[model samples]
Target: MGIEIEVVYALPDEQVVIPVNVEPAATIQDAIRLSGILERFPEIVLEDRMVGIFGRCMALDHPVQAHDRVEIYRPLHASPADARRMRAEARRRRRAGK
Candidate 1:
């Protein structure tokens, strides 16, 4: 028998979710490959990337259960601290103009 799972990837302008069926023993990587998501999005390089199940990060080798939603994560363009700093600066600028 097989398990049904969803593999998802998102970009700023687009998102894709592919439903896949794999053997019960399949791992996250196996489901991803079976879904053909890699082919559709050539920019997804798994070696340096992180993946998750429902919002929790997991290793590529992690075994997937039925109905699992596997997500491919994109690298952050800015660190969390840097992003917060930028937002604070923007807020200060707005207040000064008012």
Candidate 2:
């Protein structure tokens, strides 16, 4: 028998959820490939994007358990440093009555 798992991906306005059954020994990547999420989300690149389970980043080869929810992460539009800098600038402007 195979284990059932959910694969999820999200966009700014949409979410893609896929349910699949794979061997208990299957890796997270295996379930992802079997779920066909790549076909559904052309923008998703396994090589560049991150994958996780239950909100924790994980390796693609990580083993999957029954009912595990795998997630595909999109690349960040802005780096953390850049975001912090931008926010600081905005705060300064607001304080200065700009």
For each candidate, the alpha-carbon lDDT, in order, equals 0.94, 0.92
> Candidate 1 versus the native: TM-score?
0.94
Q: List, residue by residue over 1-98, the lDDT tens digit for candidate 2.
A: 99999999988999888999999899989989999998977777897889999999999999999999999998888999999999999999999995
Pairs of residues clashing in candidate 2: none
- Per-prediction TM-score to the true structure, in the order listed: 0.94, 0.84
Weakest 10 consecutive residues, lDDT, candidate 1? 39-48
Worst 10 residues of 2 by lDDT: 40-49
Q: Taking the candidates one at a time, how many backbone clashes does each contain?
A: 0, 0
Q: What is the per-residue lDDT of model 1 for residues 35-91, given as tens digits with 9 covering 90 to 100?
A: 998898888898889999999999999999999999999999999999999999999
Name the lDDT value of residue 49 in candidate 2.
80
Task: Score candidate 2 by lDDT.
Answer: 0.92
